[model samples]
Target: ILGLLDDSPECRAFKQQLADLSLIYGKRGERGTLVTKTVNPAPLLETLQYYFRQPADFLEKQIHLWETERNERLQSVRKTLQDYPQDVVEKFERHLKMTENANQLRELNNEWLDVPIMNYFRRLVQEFARRLTESKVLEKTIDVYHLTADELQEATAMLPEVMEVRQRVHERQVEEEKFANVTPPAFMGAYPVDAVYTLDPLTLSYLNTEAPNPVDVPGGLGAVPASPGKVIGRAKVLRCTTAIN
Candidate 1:
C-alpha cells in the first residue's frame, strides 16, 4: 500500500519493516491475521478502477503533444545545419569521421559506453547557430524571408559565433592526433633542470624567499604551504598527471 503511494527510500524501508513485523507474527502463530479489519482495500480498488476508466482521448492528446514537440526540435536542428558554410561543413564532416572512429574503438575494446553523440551533434548545431549569429546571417536571412526583427534577434541569439564553430570542429582533429604520435619524454640526461622547472629561475628564487623559511617549491618533489595555519602529519604524495587511463 505504501509502495503504491510512493517508491521513495523511506516508504521502501517502511514496507520492509511491515514484512519483518509479519514474519514476527507468523512465528508467534498469528500469521493469518495480524491486525483484524485494519486493511481497507478501497484505495487499491479505486486506483485500478481509475486506470481502467482512463479516457481513450487522453493517450491521443499526449501522443500528439509529444509528436509536435519532437517535430519542432528536429526542424530547429535542420535549420541550424542548413546555415553551415562550406568550410564549416567540411570541418564538421571531419569531426563526424573522428567520432565514428572513437565509437568503433569502443566497440572493438568491448567497452560499455554512454558517449551522448547526439549532444555532440547538438553542440555542432549550436556552433553553426553561433556562427550565424556572429555573422548576422540569421538576422539577414530572417530579414530576407520577411521575418520580424524581434524574431530574427531571438533566432540569432540562439546560434554560435563563426570562430567558435571552427574551433569546435578543429578540437576533434586535435584529439584524434593526441594518441597517434605519443612518445615518452627522454629521461637519459640529468633531468634537464631547465625543462624540469619551466618557470624562470628569478621567479622561483623570488617565491622561495617570500616565506620566512625555505618553503618547499610548488610543482616540485615537495609541498608548499597551501594555507596559513600549520599542523603536523605524514606528507602524502599527490600526483598530478594528465595521462588518460
Candidate 2:
C-alpha cells in the first residue's frame, strides 16, 4: 500500500502510526477504501494530536487512582498485621512482599508498555484519531468504523446515518466492556478455518485430498497446545473499555 497511487502513506493505519499522520481511507463491507474527503492538513493534524492526548490524559488519572488505592491498601495491610500474633504477623509480612511482587508484574501491562501489544493499542487510537480528524466525518475518532465506503466518499454527506451507526457500535462496545471474567466463547474454531484464515496475511492451505476417508468424531476443543502453542481470537478494545473498575 505504501507504493499504491491512491493509498498514501498516511492513509494506512500501520504506516500512519509510524508517520503520525492521518491516512485517507474508509471500509466497505469486506473491502478496503481510499478516502475522497479533503481538508486543510494543518488543522487536521492539530485535531489529531489533541485527540491522541486523550489516552495519555486518562493514563495520568489512572496513575493517580492507582497510587491512591495502592497506598490505602498497603496501609490497611500494615494496620491488620499489627494486631496479629508474631507467627501470623511474619506470614502476613511475607504475603505482603509477594503481593508487592505481583503488583510489579501487573506493571508489565500498566506502566511498561512495549512494542508487542499495549503500546500498539495506543498507536491504534492515534491512527484512528488521525484518520477521523482528517476526514472530518465523525466527532469521535472511533466512530470512523461506523462509516461505509459510500458514506465516506461524499465526506459529510451521510453523517447523520454515520452517527446512528456509531451509536449502535458504541452501545455494543459498552455491553462488551461490562462483561467480566470476559466470557471466553464456548469454543474458537480450529485454525485455518473461520476467522483464523482471514486473519493471517499469508495465503492459507488446507486439506486437498479428494479421496473419501472415514471421518471420526474430533475430540474436545481445549487448551492451547504445549509447544508452538497457539490461541486464535480477535478483539477490539477502546481506552474506556480497558478500565477494570
Candidate 3:
C-alpha cells in the first residue's frame, strides 16, 4: 500500500522506490525475474501527451524567443547580400568555375541569382549572334572557284603576299584608332581612362591562368595583387564588411 506524505526527503525516496517497483513489474512477471512482454505506443498520442504535460506559459515563452532570434538572423543575412551584390557575384563566379558543369549551370541559372540579370545576358548573346549573321562575318562558304592543278599552284604562290598585306593593313588601322583617342587625363583630374590591370588569384585562377604564388602574411596566404603598387609594410586583406571587426 502507498501512503500519502508531504514533500519531504523521506516522501521523495518513497516515490522513487514506487517508480522502481512499477518499472520492474512492468518489465517482468509478478515473481519471475526475466519475464519479457512488448508494449506498442501510438506516436501521435505519445507526442500529444508529452506536449500537454509541459507548462503552457513556459512553452509560449520559448517559442517567442526562438522566433525572435530566427528573424534577427534572417534580417542580418539579407542586409549583407544587399550591401555586397557585386562582391557576392564575383565570389559566386569563382565558385562556379570550380564546381559548375553543363547541367549545373542550367540549375544555377534557373534557381539562383536575379532572374532579370540572367535574362538580360541571354538576350545580349542572342543579339550578338543575330548581328553576326546579318553582317555575314562568320559565314560558312563553299568555294565554287574549283581550280585545276596548275591554277592551284599559281594561286598558292600569290597567297603568302596577299595575307602579309592584309595583316599590315589591320595593324595600321588599330594604331590609327589608338592615337585618335583624346589626350590622357592629369593625375588629379576626373576623366575616363582605360587602364589594364591584373586580377586577383580568385579571378585570375578561375580564368585558367598560372597565377603568381601568394605572399605569406599574418592571417593567411595573401590573395594575388589586383593592381600593382608599392607599400612599405604589411597589408591587411579585407574582403567583407564583417572582417572589419
Deviation from truth (RMSD, Å), model 1: 30.2
Write the number of the candidate with greater TM-score, choosing between 2 and 3: 2
Q: Which ten residues in a row have the lowest lDDT in candidate 1?
A: 28-37
Clashing pairs in 2: 10-23, 11-23
Candidate 1: tens digits of C-alpha lDDT, residues 120-188 = 444555554555645855432222233333544555565543222334334555775786788867766
List per-prediction Cα lDDT, in the order shown. Answer: 0.48, 0.48, 0.49
Write candidate 2's Cα lDDT for 1-245 as tens digits. 23342375445655445344333221111112222222234554567767687875786898899999999998987896675556556656676676567543443432322323333444555565565556554566766555555544444454433323455557666775788548677778765432221211111111222322223347933322222224244423434755633
lDDT of 3 at 107: 33
Spell out the clash pairs found in candidate 3.
Answer: none
| TM-scores, each model vs. reference | 0.19, 0.24, 0.21
Superior by TM-score: candidate 1 or candidate 3: 3
